[model samples]
Target: MTDVTSAPRELRKGANVAIRDLGGELGGLTVFLDSRGHDGETIDADVSVLLLDASGKVRSSADFVFYNQPIALNGAVHLRDKLVPEPDSDEAAAGWSSDVVTLELDDVPQEIERIVVAASLDASTARTFGDAAGVRLRLQRSSDAADLLVFDIDDATTESALVFGEFYRRDEDWKIRAVGRGYQAGLAALVTEHGVDVSEEADEPEGPEAPAVDETPDEAPAPPGDAEQAPAPPMPAEVDDDTGTSSPATPAKRSVSVRRPTRAPRLPVDWNASIPADDGNDWQAARLFPVAGIGSGEEQERRATSALLAVMSMVREFGAALTGRCGAPRGTITTYIEVPFGQDEEAYRPDGVIQVRRGTREWTALVEVKTSTGRLNVEQIEKYVEIARARGYDAVITISNELAGGDADHPVAVDRRKLRKVSLHHLSWDQIRAEAVLAARHRGVSDATQAKVLEEFIRYMSHARSGMGGLGDMGPSWVKLRDAVKSKTARASDKATGEISARFDELIQHLGHHMTGLLGVEVQSLAPREAPDHASRRQQLADSGLMFGRLKVPGAVDVLVVGADLRADKASAAITIGAPRGDTRPLTRVNWLLRQLPDEAKDSIRIEAHMAGPRAVSTAALLGKARQDPSCLVPEEQREIKAFTISLEVPLGNKRAAGTGTLIGSVKGATTTFYADVVQHLRPWVAKVGSPSRAE
Candidate 1:
């Protein structure tokens, strides 16, 4: 609708003009939506573009009215034609702006004769243009960067949708028309008029009987107001129109839970090298930086930098592992390492980028890696945050070797006020390593060959934790520790044995810490209970069931205090998966306790059929008690059942010399293997069952 009469050229409400007059070389047009609250506050509204054929019938359209998934069609001629509705902001309502619809004129199909731009109040909020001080559409021409048209609405009334303007072809030329038409109904009604298949809230079942996931199409009986509208056909099922009947309902779709794939199948660690063996040997291969003593100044710097980058690479892999651990379906999250951004050589590069998607929902996270000694500055973090926000990343996580200042378990805060919608977190390398070990262990148990690379990576991390400094001096502590274990004689002084055994103490303590951190429990090492003499302490330890440690892990019904024993010299470690004895020892419900364990634990860990010793209670006796009185299962009467007493250990090396170095090496290797075994064994129990419950 254009007028060639003596009409004002300046665009205003209901103004009609020729687009050829606006710009001759216009290749593209960007339509922007602007609205201000009564108090001059910016308001967020949906802006859309619709293309129509010569007959005024809809050809192709992009709108934010349906589930916020605006259609975007890419064209070879002009690249892209799409709608950028909102900038994924947390304060989307308060500071809302940037809802745009871009149209490449060259990309528009020849059959399309007109382009219509419109706006509507965001469906989420119960507000209309009448509640705003101003609502307008601004058209910008791409060729000359000119503001071609501005159509402002004045009489919005109680209307929620409005057609601001249109660009139409007239007599082999393009013309603009400011068609200020408003609809009292909301966007759904407005979109329906232009042929958009949007499902209405009323179509959804209102009662609790509704299925958790509705795979079938909504086909409820139409209300009086919508009697003219036909019901949607059930998807993936044919509709029989012969007798006006629908086919048998499609089989109810089962909701599937997903687990994402790990990124690194091959690690940088060399696994052929043996663990420390004898008192005399070249321990260079075991050292992270063997050339620390031989390299020149520049060579040393280069090597150090290279080593740091290698560590960062591992950190990147660790982030990829973390993404997989979030339980998304395989291929749902893809990781890109060392992805560069910004203008040139001085560009910002994140160590890794994790792209996650499940159907239409998609998001991204940037990972920044740092060593324990490296500190993240405000300026650098600010820059990364800015870049992450600009690139539309949901989160920016920094994986570092540095522990959190306040709490080791909690993430450290990077000053993130400048990041409007981007979340920032600091995860310690220790935590990442732990998670990787556990995840790799689970994968390893299923298929050891496939998980070899990840297992090697875990081993490398464990070995590197032995104080390998920043490529300075090849630390003697680790070598000395290894050597000390190899040189110990059979009959050493009591003082010397206790002092050397402290290494074992540290190793076991570390295990306790790892277990405590993972299980959210208090794990304690149980030394020979206050024995009077060395002879008495050895006897006490022998009679203590050789149980060296206990874990008091909390559960729904009661606290599960489990004990485990693993001597560095022994080939097996025993874990008693049962509750500690108390006043209600005889009333334990063995069957219910067994049910609590996942199938993996039962299959992997050897389960004892019946309890032994006078203190031990049989599963048959517990079942009889349970049968005699169901009340026996109550909290007060029920004792913790030793569900099973099983040995969980793998051969590290043959019982070598009792020297400190050999002993330490033996414990370290065994502990590393056992960690994997335990994590893999307990995974099913700890993993989230399906998904969190939602209000129906």
Candidate 2:
């Protein structure tokens, strides 16, 4: 099936290849865009293709850059029949998702002379292609594995989009050229360059609007911006025969079409329905069952504090959409998570505080978080309400595991001119989770960091046993999961292995929980290093005999935990810091942090600088390197799951500690030391990272 003269070709910027040599056997050309951002992180990118005629006039185009749409707004009849832009494919590899355009050469019209393929970052992400790593373009035949052209972009740091290459007709022969041109203004600019009408779109409202239906001429102007200028087709003037007089025509009456605003869909389940009347403060009760010298009770309290702060942080970052999903007065909402109150820093401190500002005037919202299974007391509510009122707050919110007997309208606000009356309201953690899911799905969240935080927080709470709602019971609680698997009778063959793996998974979950409770920060489990090779990845994690985990705390260099070879009779604790993926300024931030730490503090911890090149490490290389140094931290192991191309590892506790029992205590002690180290070095770093960006 091969053509004698046809051959695959690789290309760089400004290079060209003859399409005639691509072969007559080629039925169609497939343009594949592989977006590798950091460490398999989600980077929403758009791939568009433009069809041009001989004179370079654009005849048709295809793209999926609009909200909720995965394909071009309009279809080109000359292109492939299947117009799905974000077509699902089984071949998508780890650390990379692909979008493809198929060109049916046989179906291409004779007038079509060229096709240009391009990639762009969505405006919502506020990122450019340069912000993304390892973006690649390839042209090849669908039937044949051979590639006609491959373009690996080395740098596009300031550009949002770039033309990877183009196919064109040169006299009787078809040829391909490596364009590699960038568009800093994103896809809009690129489309404009290809003759798209972007000016009309620019004039339209920046916010989302409902689709227009058949409407009267008078109402048409209120709809689309383009329709505002278009004059309705004129009607002929009416004449009265009896008087032989000409009269101006009256426009025909049109039907009035009115659509109500879309309402947010209710959560699938009433989150409050399953809440037990009494929880006996099980979160705290469970903490009483501590392993070794770790004060589980104190740890749980700290975790509760952290969880509260995390919630406030989400509310703070997402603002009205997150905290006021039920509704808030129209204005910018700002929140401070766990900030001290009163004139003194050591005075009364609340879990969270919010300020909704409308012009010069502002209303305050004070929040108290309770993660344990407990009911809000009338006295506590009254006290907090009194405190809020005294502090001039308009509202007081208490977050707990159970829903109080009241309507969904909790934390309702009544605005007054000078001072507003503070209202008391109780919110269940499940409610927060539900709102986050809703916001993520329908609110079109733009900040990648906020989105990631929301997602991770949800995952963290899903496993948390205290909350009430779908998140409370949809899956087995960690305790129930551990018990169910641990109680199963041992068997031979396949079933035995499954049981063992299930038990191991529980151990991993316990480790995550232990860390969350102890560290008072979000901690997540990671798949075993050998997970990819197994059909049942969960089982692989158990079989790997090494527990791996990640930490998520803003501004601090990412930290990781790897339990020393679990299969070994004895193990020690290890924490990796200065993880590079997701952290663009890893070196600068980490070095700055290290410098601030006292000499004695720095000398106590083992620090290794595993710096590489300026460019991000490829996923394959990272994985291989991980295998080479099991003790070394990699990007995939980081909280954001990015290529921590460079990092530092600090092993806690001495190798003298042995036995599984000692492992727990050793880890507990090491974790304590690690926290101290982080507080000394990383806390200040987080403060710097979280501060507002300064004017350059």
Candidate 3:
């Protein structure tokens, strides 16, 4: 509950958050952001605030406390920059799949000491893709300008090895850049890299050290106006020791007071054990999928990780560990775990299967994993039960994260990426997460590892997901979720989620191939938009005349414009341009048009953004408006009735400019505008006929 009296004035200033623009689509953007506290300090262990289109009310609501995380903007992060419809393997690529504004260099320049490159993908652009193509890498370089057939280093795959290439040479300063592309979306660096490697990190005259990481060269230091040059070398250092040995001597051996032996992390089951050799081509195959997402070596790894997490979430819901308390921590405690329905037997273990001195009831659960494209068939459920029964587990459970799906009828499809609707009995992702955590902990997982796993679980719960979202969701979060009903309700879901058991009569009925489906390996619909609600929302969209969408996650605008940093006249594809605002000089039309849009929309595209205003549409908006507006074109005989004008003149005025100095008073609208080559274009469509209007 919020304290109304303590709310800040800014919260009351206005209720509107001008949204990003969309061209020709009814965007249902749902974003999650954390509101800062009144004291300007962030409230952490944060929560997500949603910008939702709940039945078209356009509300900004907070669902629940969400784990604090770094900001995520799809285009801005995941697809930092995209190439013009290119692939990840197109050229040399480095850095994270996220992070916009990466510093990139065409070539490592000589005389340079450091380098930084920034790359980004517009938020608006990112939302357009449900998912698509992968990223690739090419380590490009050249001994001579024409000698640039730089070697290709694909995303890492055990088979596609380009083990070693001179990432850096002792003499030559290498130049590097990454080119990326998407499905129907433009290409750009998802984000920029300050430096590719240790050496490329530009050194501060009085700052940090530089190491050699990237092939790109450092920035060239300009020649001193009248000073002689001095030579320098990479820094070297030495350490001192207290032992009788020299200062650089190694540490003396010490007795092991606490021997916490390290253990290897649990690894994925080898596909070869269960399935035929795939050439380990899942990543490569993804590149050809209808909607293959980023294929950057790291991106593939990330997606794999995401899918793995989804699977893990379900596993926990199925009860991987058997934990039994003597009611007290004293009775012998024992836990058994495994995958209930996974390809691997280890994943079906259970919790609470201990031999207690006082109690005899067994706490046995069979944790399982299922990777499928669509809905479940009951027969599959029985198979899982059989496996559980064979293992003498108390309950049989199934789970999976990537549930690729399709239409409601044929919801079960085998999706390689598992992008679909999912179901495992009736357990929800959170329930699965909690149970999995308990199971893992009972099974002896370390506290630190448990925390990391919990973190991933929270992220899986945070998307405005579709298709398999419900399966992962267990059920909707909004339903009967009162604190009182939660535990009881969860109990009900837990039974459903944990219903698999070899002894249940339903198991036999579920086993026959003719039994249809119960769970595991059946796909649900991953197709994002199919509900009839779209019809209602579409009507609302018509009334608004503005495309609306939710971010589903935090997002930013990434409009591509002919103009960057806002120029008087620029081109962009995102905005729809109308006739110029007035008969006034073409340049003056901006002020007139700026008044036409709602203040919110105005801020969205940043009209007159140069001046300090609450919010300004970006330069991309202005450029897009300019390029798309019909008014910018010449009239064609009877073919087009619209009229417009083009002229060249020196306006008299003063207008403060952006990125540069101020311009004062005009023979123009504001004498405060700046210098322009003497030509212009003008067109007017809006008829503000009434009284004397400032723009008119």
Top lDDT model: 2
Model 2 is weakest, by summed lDDT over 10 consecutive residues, at 214-223
**Predicted structure 1: lDDT:** 0.44
**Candidate order by decreasing lDDT:** 2, 1, 3
lDDT for every model?
Answer: 0.44, 0.45, 0.24
TM-score-superior candidate, 1 or 3 = 1
Encode model 2's per-residue lDDT on 228-344: one tens digit a residue.
121232444567789866543322222211211121112223322544588566563332122224245435444554654555445443455344432233345666656766532
Q: Model 2 Cα RMSD, Å?
A: 24.9
Against the correct fold, how does model 3 do in TM-score? 0.21
Tens digits of lDDT, candidate 1, 1-696:
111333323566545666667653333565666666754366656565556554354532342222233333332011111222333443334443445565556445676666667776644344778887767676665422356666677777776666777766666666677666666565545554543444423322221111121112222122222222222322344666787554443322222211111111111223226576677866644444344353343343333334433443344333334553332221245566678899334687766676765445465777666552454465666677788788776777665444432112223445546756776665554555555554454212234543454555445445443221211111223334323444432122333333323333333444443543344223333332232443443233333312233322222121222222223434344444443222224333333334334343323333342343566564332323434453444433344443444334433332233223343344444443433333223211111123212111
TM-score of each: 0.31, 0.30, 0.21
Best by TM-score: 1
- The clash numbers for all candidates, in the given order, read 11, 3, 163
For candidate 3, give the lDDT of residue 276: 55
Which structure is stronger by lDDT: 1 or 3? 1
